[model samples]
Target: MRIKIKKESCTGCRLCEQICTIWHYKEINPKKAAIAIEPHFPEPGIFEPKLCVQCGICAKECPVDAIHLEGEAYVLHADECTNCGICVEACPIDVLYTHADVPTPLKCDLCLKCTEVCNTGALTVVRRSD
Candidate 1:
């Protein structure tokens, strides 16, 4: 499955981030959430929810090579990662966020939890055709 976000529909509610963090980590911290909504400041009243393009830069740049493509998604082996920040620098969209307290980075797994709760219909999951 894959998620496609309609940027125009996002209301800056940030409910996607909240639900993601809660579902994945059982917490309310937005910083830990895989998805991020960065406001377009100076333009006022505009928000952009960053979507993971599923690009492999993070996996490709891992110094320990800890991030691996497993079963259609990049899964990070936190234990194996040396936290060299190479992947963080490689992400073109800046979706990868450094966990303030943890050595590992956080990103979307295309789990679709955000899709289920998005009342705006901004998020969607579709099967990838082989």
Candidate 2:
């Protein structure tokens, strides 16, 4: 599964980020969330919601084999990660990020928790074809 972002529909309210953080970390921290909303202020203001597309780029770039595909979701093996930051660099959309408190990388797990709280329908889960 992967998340489809509607950039024009996003209002910069950060509902998706909030829900993601709360669901995964049990907190209200936006920095810990898997999804990010980048805002372009002044002149033409736009809210760009960036998220993982589950393209497996990170998994293929992992030198330590820390990233793997489990079913349709690409997950990170924290214990095996070397904090190389290769996954973060490998992400084409720049959605993968390093944990603030940990040395490991973090990406969207396609849990669909964020989509549940997104009132604007800016975030939607796309199921795998297979």
Candidate 3:
């Protein structure tokens, strides 16, 4: 499934980010979460919940074929990755992030946990036909 973000509806409550990090890493750190709620100041109520849109560009550009589509989200196979950082450069929207502790980049895996806790309806899971 793909996640649809309604940026305007975001309240910056950060429930999505919290749940994401907890589910993936068993922590409460938002920085390591796949989803990020960024604030755009001087723009009134603009909080963009940045995430993977599952465009498949990262998977297509990976030289080692480390990345693949899990429904509409991209899933990285850590063993196949070469740490070339090619996929990071290849992502058109730049949602992929690297952490100091993790070998591979962090991104949404479509666990649906974030969408389940999104109180503002900013995040929604969208299932595709293919």
TM-score of each: 0.89, 0.90, 0.89
Give candidate 3's error at residue 32 in angstroms.
Answer: 0.8
Candidate 1's C-alpha runs over 4 A off are: 41-44
- Give each prediction's root-mean-square deviation over alpha carbons: 1.9, 1.8, 1.9
| Highest lDDT against the true fold, candidate | 3
**TM-score of predicted model 3?**
0.89
Candidate 3 lDDT, tens digit per residue, 57-101?
888999988888765567888888888888889888888888787
* Tens-digit lDDT string for candidate 2 (1-130): 5677888888999888888878877887878888888999884798888888888889999999888899888988778989888889888889897666857776788888888888887987776552
Ranked by lDDT, the better of candidates 1 and 3 is 3
lDDT of 1: 0.81
The lDDT values for all models are 0.81, 0.83, 0.83
